[model samples]
Target: MAKFKYIDHGQGGAPACMTLAEREWEQPAGRQVLIQVAYAGINRPDCLQRAGAYPPPPGASPYLGLEVAGRIVAIGPDVRGRKVGDEVCALTPGGGYAEYALADERHCLPVPKGMDLLAAACVPENYFTVWTNVFDRARLAKGEKFLVHGGSSGIGLTAIQLAHAFGAEVWTTVGNEEKAQACRKAGADHVILYKEQDFEDAIKAGTGKQGVDVILDMVGGDYINRNIRSLAVNGRLVQIAFLQGSKAQIDATPIMVKRLNFTGSTLRPRSDEDKGLIAQALAEKVVPLMEQGKCLPVIHKVFPLAEAAQAHALMESSQHIGKIALKVQE
Candidate 1:
């Protein structure tokens, strides 16, 4: 078998390393399909995997890619609705960053026509995260105000476009003025420069002091409290990650006083069946938005498979304005 070197972390706090002289192993038995990876998206979870904090579950591949887009080369027995030569993207619990990866049929999504593999690779993680947390969990509605932190990020940009396309008012917080502008260009109704202005104040001013109907937050800790205060009546705040440390001294009084609903989730920890449901939702709802060009994936850069370290460095700098992709094959 031809081997494809991948980026991985061994165990406990070690820096990410690449192993090139490795051989591709045979696929395991399951209702799965082997994909000849064309592109893989680099995500924050991948960074966690590289730091040895995140690992694939038992019975899953140890390789560290959560989403990939490519062509199907082989299918397991009893698989249906797909076949060899299909261009598709799917969520993976592990083993995404390689020449080939296995995907359960239920989680596979047909790539939209005319979409490049790199852009398709960028969609699954961000789209699934945004849709599940923002729409499915929070029940965001049309004409409601939706706010997202890290507005120019992979998740934030996806949320902005999807919410706007669904007739909701979209607002976001970005690190700099340039990113704020990029968020606006991506159909955000308003952009807050967290550097120059307090996001709470920006949100208040933007909504005439009514606050937002929903907020998608990845930065936890102190922002947890502020996120609640930033909500409208019956508002929902979905916490996705804690880039600023999870623990913090916060006042939860606002939750009762404002009657806000707080929720959050991690996609990689979810069961395959649940992920399949999210994928089905994406196929029915979000894919049409992509086909109409309303909520397409925005890629910042594409790095070759070998330079995975450099990709992590760029993401660490918090400088990227959209999704970063890895080109797995020429």
Candidate 2:
């Protein structure tokens, strides 16, 4: 079978300038299932990796995609809970941007009942991210206030909805009025226009100067100090990415003063066992939410696989309000 592959990284030029071509794919190995990918969701990590800033961990596949939804075409020996023709969504270590992708059994999540395969593709990356970093690491709980940056992003939108689903008051920052409305629709109690208002000030005012209970911060650098200031007593800040820049000069006083916890995680580098625990939790906890219509995947656009360049362009534009997906089937 033919699959799309990341042929090279383009450091100084546009993402489209980097090569993507169809290539012959091999069959699955032991404990691995070969997925006939129906749809693949594009994420920020894919873009960073393409720019040669982030490379896959040692021994990981060279292909560049983090999530996919499709049917299992072949199952390796010792794999359980799945069979050929079973529809599933999976967190890929790599090789997701292709017609056929291999996934270890632990990383696979079953497609929610009554959900379309394309829509299911959007669920794994965002849900796994929020579940691991926000709920598991930060220990966010009911009745707490949660604030997220880039509320219109795939990760942000998912976090807003899930935090609201589990009884937290949610707030988010967005680039424009349109995205702010989108955030509100996704269950954010308040939306701050980050380009206009200082988010720390707006959040403090919204909370009556009490600050939020947890902050899901993707922006680093200058946002670090303010994020500490925007937290309640014993608050938690979970960092998933540093879109602005990672290095920063900041005071540690707020963290010590407020007893705030600052931490973050990336899914790719984690062990298979850890990812399995997360997958199991998501399948039991979050999948029911989607089945009951309490939470769902939001797609900003779906481009044909051949238009992968355009899909990356749209995501890079920072204008899309939700997940951008690549359609593998007509």
Candidate 3:
């Protein structure tokens, strides 16, 4: 049996726990394709998994990493559209940190024209989450006002660009001026310094108490109530993660009075078919924008596969303004 190198976090602790290790290779099965990974994206969920807070779904690989960009080297019997030597980016079911990984053929997407593997590696996790939650679940529409918390994050920047491209007004909350500028450069109409000013107050004052039409938030806890209060009459609030804390004491009055929609989702646990649909949507709608240099991913840093610990440290420090990736092949 062949072996490949991957990041291993024994018993799951801090970023320091991750180390390069070798694992026996497994052949592609079912509709899966084996990818010779060139790059793997570093996401928040990957950190959570390393810390033992988030666990992989049943039947999913227990390793870290949710997305990768590479060339398809082998395909299972049921694979049809993908084949050997095809360059693609994929949303993996886990184990993206390895030199090679397995991905459902339906969840793999062609690398956008003129985009490199590094940028392609950053696309699947952020794009799929933003598309499904902000558009499919929240029903964001053209000309509406939109706001996203953590403006400098990969997800935040993606939402800002996509919403602005689709003709919606974009607002975002950032920790500092640097992130604010980054968000503005990404097409945000309003950038609020969450540290210097109250987001709810800013929203209330900016819109004359009308609030925004939709808000995509990852910081839960107390922000939940403020998110509820900082909405227009028919506004929608989509929660993706709880960086602060999941448990919140929020008033239910606003939920009923405003006719608001409060919803959210996690990408890794979703069915393969659901992720395939999202991939199809991205290929049809967003890939053209990427080809035209619109709504492209912003990469802040890239580390060699062995330095995954340093990458995770940078991510947890919340200092980077865009996506982080690990170079797996070269």
Best by TM-score: 3
For residue 245, model 3's alpha carbon misses the true position, in angstroms, by 0.5
- The stretch of ten residues in a row with the least summed lDDT in candidate 3 is 261-270
Q: What digit string (tens of lDDT, one per residue) describes model 3 on residues 93-136?
A: 99999999999999999999999999999999999999999989
Better of 1 and 3 by lDDT: 3
Tell me the tens digit of each residue's lDDT in model 2 across 57-168: 9878777788999999998987877899888999988878778888987889888887888889998889999999989999889999999999999999999999999999
Per-model C-alpha RMSD: 1.6, 1.8, 0.6
Assess each prediction's global lDDT (C-alpha) against the native: 0.85, 0.87, 0.95
**Candidate 1, residue 260: how far the Cα is off, in Å:** 1.4
TM-score of each: 0.95, 0.95, 0.99
* Candidate 2 accuracy as TM-score: 0.95
* Model 2 residue 288 distance off true place after TM-score fit, in angstroms: 0.5
lDDT of candidate 1 over 52-92, digit per residue (tens): 76675666677778899999988888787789999999887
